[model samples]
Target: MQASHTLAELEAVLGEQVKKLRLSRNVDQTLLAERAGISRRALQNLEAGTGSSVASLLSVVRALGREDWLSLLAPATTINPLTMVRARRERQRATSVRAKSPTAK
Candidate 1:
């Protein structure tokens, strides 16, 4: 997918992909919608890329046995060793420098 793709375009692509997956599995919209616990219209909306709730999308994806796709949206974070070291070396308190007094004659 191009980085410049509009939201609508992306949605349409996603809907098309879902439709393709369903077709590959030989599942019809009615059966898939029933398995997903959503209305056939909801599935149609999702597959048509018209619009659908996140819940409906997730339900459909789960019904299709593709829940792993959701993990891609929020992969586990990995901490950088350099960032960790810098954080550990940060100063905990401030110290003021003392001014030298005039020397006695």
Candidate 2:
């Protein structure tokens, strides 16, 4: 389905994927947590979609030999010439306005 989901739903989906990946690799939760340098409870919480820190998530993904996933989370930013021009013009307008505003003595 191409339907959009809530943030909680997205987290739940990610948690399930992590759990499945761990199982497919024959890794137990305790072992995975130890390898990720996190507590077993943290892993559990992550799998349950309750809560998790970004560091913890990265650790777990790395422990699973999936560091490449980080790229998917944050793609490289590229400059847009049009946007840059628009921002520059906007800044110039703002500077002119401040210069013309009467100062309070």
Candidate 3:
């Protein structure tokens, strides 16, 4: 998908994909909604790209056997080698000498 696309455009594309998947599986809105534990209207809204809750979207995708696709939204975190090297080179504690008070002089 193009980064330049608007949010609505992206939502429409996602809705189309979900609708296609459901059709391919021979599942109707009611049946899919039932399996997903969501209302049929919720499924319709999702398929129509009107709007949907994240919970509803996840439920429908899980019911459609596409939960794996959600993982792409948040991949595993990897440590940065440059950051690790810099951390190793940095001092862990301050060791500066304190100034003597005027009264001590």
Q: Best-fitting candidate, measured by TM-score?
A: 1
Cα displacement (angstroms), candidate 1, residue 77, comes to: 0.7
The per-residue C-alpha lDDT of model 3 at residue 14 equals 90
Find the 10 residues in a row with the least total lDDT in model 2.
89-98
lDDT of 1 at 11: 87
The true-structure Cα RMSD of candidate 2 reads 8.6
lDDT of candidate 2 over 15-59, digit per residue (tens): 898999999999999999999999999999898888888888999
Residue pairs that clash (backbone atoms under 3 angstroms), model 3? none
1 against 3, candidate with superior TM-score: 1
Q: Clashes in each model (backbone N, CA, C under 3 Å)? A: 0, 0, 0
The regions of model 3 sitting more than 4 angstroms off are: 89-105
**Ten residues in a row with the worst lDDT in model 3?**
83-92
- Of 2 and 3, the candidate ranking higher by TM-score: 3
TM-score of every model versus the real structure: 0.81, 0.70, 0.80
Candidate 3 structure quality by residue, lDDT tens digits, 34-69: 999999999998998889989999999999999888
Better of 1 and 2 by lDDT: 1
- TM match of model 1 to true structure: 0.81
Distance from true location, Cα of 58 in model 3, Å = 0.5
Ranking by TM-score: 1, 3, 2
| Tens-digit per-residue lDDT, 1-105, candidate 1 | 899999889889989999999999999999999999999999999989999899999999999999998999899889999989887866888999977778843
